[model samples]
Target chain A: MTDLYLQDWRAWTPHRETAGECRLDTREKPAGAAVPSMLRRRLNLLGRAVCDMLATLDSGADSIVLHASRHGDGERTLEMLYGLNDGEPLSPARFGLSVHNATVGVYSIASGNRRSQQAVAASGGEWAALMAEARGYLADGQPSVIIVFSDQPVPRRFAAYAPESSSAAVVLRLGRDPNPGARRLSETSVELELETATLQPLDIIDWLMDRRRVVACPLSRRSWQFPAVRP
Target chain B: MTTTALEHELKEMIIETLELEDVTPDDIDRDEPLFVEGLGLDSIDALELGLALQKRYGITLESEAESSRQHFANLKSLAALVESRRQK
Candidate 1:
């Protein structure tokens, strides 16, 4: 196991958007149109997000990357769905943006990234699932890098799934400094457990990534924060 | 499919993939160029269309092609390339 580390994290949102603005959006009211714009708001946001992340990570030219979002650009999908509901068929533009990889496409194009981006969605366990994937990359001997992203909830059509929580992004890295024992297929094994208390998977994710870590695991979540090394 | 049908399909795919915003299959001229003052595609469009073509058919575009400019000239040329490179 590589010594996993939280390299850093970055997030972006328009003044009108709320998938991520930190505590800027503290509304417990129902999520609705007033919520922040998630993906597809502005290409500038995509570039801004990626550029800021690169700086924060100190990522090299060849650093591998993975991004996770439960509803990748679902706000755009909701808009398209609403258009469809009005008996007005979706425009071709709407169709393109509706695809899950649209933002991924934008990121790749803007950054000129050569390595493939690991974009995955876990429906509910978005963060934990993505965290696991990031760890896999770390264990695989790649300079493990992961980016977790989520957007604000859509309109009332998705009311049950919403309290319009703000979106966030956290970037984790591993392998720069090797860990000892319980590291790999050799000597011993280490089990990495991430438990969250927030009702929303994203809420749990928010808890795990919060600077203060509102929730705590029995042992030291920070000590084990570094992955076991395979020395 | 006939050449015209292939061209139509290619146009649809372009409009769909590029998010051309206000374009339709009918809006595109069958023989119009797709790049450089035609459909006006840039590098990103090339990447997306290339991927879509590979999945739809089995012809993977050479990422480092020297003359992709001429290859993506327009819908007609793209249709021809797709037909000629159609997987056996």
Candidate 2:
């Protein structure tokens, strides 16, 4: 769908906070209430994914969002279980933070865009669901939804049931067209291999980046070489 | 286990388990507080440490348990709990 003017893209990792960088007083997330370390790892990873999207996007996008971890805050779920056993003495803040929408909520809060569209997909084909929603939102042929795909590794608690890969988050700005010099959703990922098995998007990027070629490899899978984008 | 070894082991576990990044195993003092002064661990760290203890030692400390405070009070205290749990 990204037919024209979509070419520019950039990527980056946040500079590690130096001791001096840590001097900037960071506000407490979940405020005065503490979330588990794993949950905080999710929060931090969310920030990284969003930043990557913002930094690399063609800049033609007016609205954006992130889709992350199919598990959708498993650590929070774990905490909820813990809270129940701990006399049901749940922390209101932590409890509030456990909602599935909280991932997008944090982004909305950070960007000061109450109107920004964000969603989480518990599985691969959910992108089509978002695209379907976009069609309704953009019936006028105007761009609307910028879908992002980010996922974190599943926690050990659910390892047996809905096993997950390592921690990861991915952001994509889905729309009609990106910016000038931007690469359109060229070739329209004609036939995707949505593994009934979970796929980690970031892993795909890393593999492509490593091979400097878009190996047909699904992000999480290793054995199969689908097709490299180019040499 | 004697008190010194217990403290030594506690410090080792905290440093290794948390990936404290800024602190080394040797930096932690046995008598130093675990929550604030020494490692600056927050409640989440407590949960993580609890999980680690359970995984490694097969022992758990409930939040409401009276002995939990005494067990988690400091490195020395935690070591004592670990030693006793091991004995049992």
Candidate 3:
């Protein structure tokens, strides 16, 4: 079991209620003004959402960033695949941005953040893996870790493979000490029953907003539990 | 040198292919450098532009060739290259 404190969090989605400082506006794409136009132009919906959340999170410079996604920029990959099948060369920009770590790499470059950045992808328990990675960073004596989880609907061709396909990003700052307004996040191993994989970001947002208690994220055979936020 | 119709077309192609939302064909100076200076495009943009040129006009560039650099130097040079070597 791993115990960590959530220093702060911000989440974004196409459909969500405005919660405190975090506003949900689905009318327009996130400007991501922190990122220069050159790099911003390359961000897709998921990347923009992640950047948007990061902009408001105000993560410290020393904090490590971990980006977790179930299907990272699958649409870009699909486009490149189509071009290759048609005997046409892929767009170099699209080809470069198709990797799972591309968005976080762009974020790191845009923010001028030289801290360690990592990307992870798992079939069902990506959120747990992300938190575990953050825990590992904390164990390594890092003061804080920024975890960004972003996922979007896969291309239509691969939609059937994903149980839950939605666009959302959640950014959480984790630390060893519980600061003011911080929530306690506890990870415990539990027997996992057969359950459809839920969109972890939305679940996290719901938990942060006090709409839900205890985020039970099931990976393969084990589940990570986050106990209810203490008052 | 005057901006020819081909140069204008190439500018449009650059703006569209690069997704330069703030840039228009008229915003591109015919003689301005396209890399690291005038238009502020980088190596990735150059590669994307190369692929766009290949797809639209069936043009290709040899890797690391001094002549290729000259052809991609500016809008006028790119239009001239297309005029001479376009397969489609």
Candidate 4:
């Protein structure tokens, strides 16, 4: 188990449009001004949330990207399916962007960051998987890794089983060096415990944003503790 | 619709269907390429445009792969395809 420092992070979600259903106190939609219109037009709600978080995070080409999503843009998949079922030609863009890693691909091209990218789809242990992946990058002696986790509620058809959440995105820049540059926000040490999982990364983001230290979140069958962040 | 009107409608359809908020019909060159270099559209856009054209014109694009590819080559080609099919 390695102690990872949380150099920087950002979270985003829709506020007004989803106020009735999604209770998360999220900010307004992301403008994604940096992204060209060509690619931005293709982004759905999930992709928009990710782009919003990325726009706020000061990431560079050197940073490794790790994207985690419980259910990636499920709504888009449903739309494509409906179109196909109706014997209508599916939009190639919609079909292409429905995949798990479509957001990652768009980010790479839009941000011009050719660094290695990883996409993780976890049914329950997503946070654990993301942390583990970041640890591997740190062990490789990389300076920093950008981990983005996002999820959106599935269509009404799957809502019974999945009970989708409002669209959300959390971006974390993990680094080995505790003393990050001027962009340094806070430092967190992650330790995976052997207990059953309970809390999630989104909960951790809220806690961290609220400046709450000493958080104990679960990872898979184990629990991890994030001690108070240091300057 | 006349050629100019058809071009205008096509542009509107492309923008609305593809969700290209920043682009207007006037911005499109009549004979400019639709995918990649000119409009920077990809295969996905092609599929979407094809579907949109089919629905708007009340016609089915021929399944001839190579000919269909040519019809989608640019706004001019797409316009021609729409015009011919609508007239037929």
Instruction: Kindly list the per-residue Cα lDDT of model 1 for residues A167-231, writing each as its tens digit.
Output: 44444444444344212211122333644332233443444444333332212232123223433
**Candidate 3 on B1-88: residue-level lDDT in tens?**
3448788788888998999977888888989999999988989998888888888888878868999899989988888899989899
Ranking by TM-score: 3, 4, 1, 2
Cα lDDT tens digits, model 2, A105-158, are: 655544455555655564554434444455455564656455554455566777
Candidate 2 has a DockQ of: 0.04
Best by TM-score: 3
DockQ of each: 0.04, 0.04, 0.81, 0.73
DockQ metric, candidate 1: 0.04
Choose the strongest candidate by DockQ: 3
lDDT of 2 by residue, B8-64 (tens): 777778777665645766777667788855667767577767767776777867878
- Candidate 3 local lDDT, A93-209, one digit each (tens): 888899989988888888777888899988767887887788898888877789988887778987787675677788888888878977777665567565745546777767777
Better by TM-score, candidate 4 or 2: 4
lDDT of 1 by residue, B1-88 (tens): 8998888888888876665645778878867777657666666567777767876777777778865666787777788898999783
Tell me, by lDDT, which candidate is best.
3
- Those runs of model 2 whose alpha carbons end farther than 4 Å from true positions after fitting are A1-42, A48-68, A130-140, A186-196, A203-231, B1-88
Q: What is candidate 4's lDDT per residue for A1-231, written digit by digit as tens?
A: 455677777666652233342323265656766578898888875676676566556455556789988778788888889888998777777788888999988888888888889888877567768877988988888777888878766688889976436566778788877754323233244565645343344555555555454444344443344543444
Chain A TM-scores in order: 0.61, 0.60, 0.90, 0.79
